[model samples]
Target: MSTAQPPEDRNTLEDSLDALPELSYSMELVQKVQGGEGGAMDELLERYQPRMRRIIAIKMGAKLRRQIDVEDILQEVFLIAFRKIEGLELRSKASILRWMAKIAQNVMHSKVDYFSAQKRSAGKEVSLHGLAPSSDSLEPQISAGVTSPSQRAARSELQELVDRQVERLEPADYREVILLRDYQECEWDEIGSLLERPTVAATQGLYRRAHLKLRKQMRKHLEHPE
Candidate 1:
């Protein structure tokens, strides 16, 4: 009556799950969405929405948050993403979110431009949480001090692996902290401010724990890649 899978069969199933491709920006997902696969776009958007919302919040800041709801901005951002999904280029596993972030920046800038024009005409000044309408580049895409693998192929593999593992970080804030500090290149204080960490030390502590968890997962995957 046990009816459980045999040990060998269970091992195979676990390996399959371990090897399951990164959910959101996988080549298969992109192709599915571009090829008009039903529900593909929905799945893709669902996977990336939380990260996208944080990006919008940082870009919009507290000042802009009062003027426009983040959800409203997210609607426009996703609308544009849906319309333009075909043009998405996946240079690396990180590419999809990068492309989406650019779209978000453009959308936020356009709204800021409208507000800036209104303020100028009214002889009032407008500020977007200390960001100007012309501000570009959501922090620099610098290395988070991770050593690159020597071989180009290995490097690319490692980068994709890192991207996948970062997406898998848990407790939401852990993912957000790594994203804000490493991916978005936010300063410690800025990360604290955006995440409401109360202090730079708090943000750093979260980043360390998140980074450790990510590294442990990455090592397990690399050691037993399936």
Candidate 2:
């Protein structure tokens, strides 16, 4: 008689299998790019531009978004990506996408820093820390349950660990759920369209499952770190 494997064991087996990278269209273009085919680079830019734009828009705060154009930021990101592409060790299509996303985030952060400095220099800076929290405000507090700087740092590190695990998730769809829903903050409908799901409900379900899986993985990692 065959006995059923536990969920965790089954998941581990599946993840091990899925960890092997397969050659995809994006990977093919990356190879062409490495071979000095300039057209491949343009094709990659065209393929990923929309998604990169959405990520930039979502990550750019309201203050920066008002002062700078998203398209300009995107252009800068693409240029940086192009220059750095030669140095990248392309592991998979997801790795390429993640590399571009990291570039976009860095560009957005630089813009935010520039504008913030300008505001300070102009004497127009506002201090939100002096004001009381509003009922509708979603800003998290460092003192609610957190007491020390180390605790805050630990929380931040934990968040980063979770994000890394999400990026490393097998079956690219699972990774897309976290990227779209949590990182990009895309609407359920938009996620459905991007993922080609039948409906918003389906996208929501995918996000929920992916989130739970991530949480489980984090817990296991914390309990038994390698």
Candidate 3:
């Protein structure tokens, strides 16, 4: 009887364990934080911080970037999320990131306002126009797993260059489409809803036109840099 009856018992135990319900990684953290578990908020922030950082960096542009550190913007985003997390439905993992991206965009806008006010006080001209986003023509081919400091510096430089050209996109809707499609990773349906387009096809058409216009601008930059 040296544990000879154990195989069936182990199989039953494994089956029972497998049958237990499991929450998604995001949902689990969200639940814990909402339930007021210690450290849950920090864990949630840590998990989502990287993506938010990238969004802030990509959207802040050269002017806002000069006046505000990316980390500061990210911190504000996380603070807003933490305060409002309990009320957020966070229906899905994608929802969590989408919510954060929206918050980050808002934070960027606020910072821009503050900076513009300062410029106005100094009697400097402030322009509300923004260029379009990444171009299909000259977008940088950043290799995967290139996370060294030098590579990050190179990527940031290229991104800033692209961003500078985007500021020249005519009509604000073009910029909004690029930010929604590329940075926010929104579905066509969601983007259409936000953009007030009647259909997904219409939303896509707008994005295509915006992309082509941005590409032309980027091409000009590559061809002639002053």
Candidate 4:
């Protein structure tokens, strides 16, 4: 007469469920919100809010903190999502989170377009030739005014410079590996998830290729001394 299931029964159930393809939880929450569930909306907010904050913080932390807060962006995204969510056609049940993320892209794109249009109207050329992204050399001994404290400072600056240079890599895969190894500083195994490759292959091939390109660019930059 005991109601409790045996451990074997529970294990079998869990194993069966785990056998199916796993899906992202965000999509589930978004669908729930779309169904007019108040609690689901709140749950979506709670779940995505932290990720939104971290992404914005990492991208724009040095900007004017007084002008914008990440929470404000989250609010804006929520409002925008509400207005546009009805129009979205579900590509797949799994794509709900991706669709909402596209909304975020549009929000950011619209703001950027507005500001850029305004800047152009003022007759200002935003692009300064030679001021665009350029790589730098890390030849410590070759540069002057770089010894002891100054050398350490120069080394730090060079590291930052190399990081910035990595952002300019062309082709999606090349840039991705560089970002994984340099900016986000994620492990090869973690990077593989983003790249959809084996960890050993990602490290040996993509990582190595990216690093070689970086080294060549750095040497060239030092030679030019710009």
Clashes of each: 0, 0, 6, 0
Count of clashes in candidate 3: 6
For model 2, residues 176-205, the per-residue Cα lDDT tens digits are 766755444445665688788998777777
Clashing pairs in 3: 130-167, 131-166, 131-167, 131-168, 131-169, 132-166
Q: What TM-score quantifies how close candidate 2 is to the native fold? A: 0.49
RMSD of each: 17.5, 18.0, 14.8, 16.4
- The clash number for model 2 is 0
Scored by CA lDDT, what does every candidate get?
Answer: 0.60, 0.58, 0.61, 0.46
> 1-226, model 3: which lDDT tens digit per residue?
1112222222321221111112287788888988988478887776656445555665665556667787888889999998888877755335776788778878777777777898899998555432112211111223344557786565555655655554556666777666565544567777788889998778878877776777777777778986
Candidate 1 has a TM-score of 0.50
The prediction achieving the highest TM-score against the true structure is 3
TM-scores of the models, in the order given:
0.50, 0.49, 0.67, 0.42
Model 1 lDDT at residue 98: 65
Of the two candidates 1 and 2, the one with more favorable lDDT, higher being better, is 1
lDDT of 4 by residue, 48-167 (tens): 443333333223222212234545555687777666665655444224334444455455544445545766999853332111111122323322344687665655464445544444
TM-score of 3: 0.67
State the lDDT of candidate 1 residue by residue for 69-162, as single tens digits. Answer: 7788887988898999999977654567667777887988878778888999999978754321211111121223324444433434444455
Span of 10 residues, lowest total lDDT, candidate 4: 128-137
**Residue pairs that clash (backbone atoms under 3 angstroms), model 4:** none
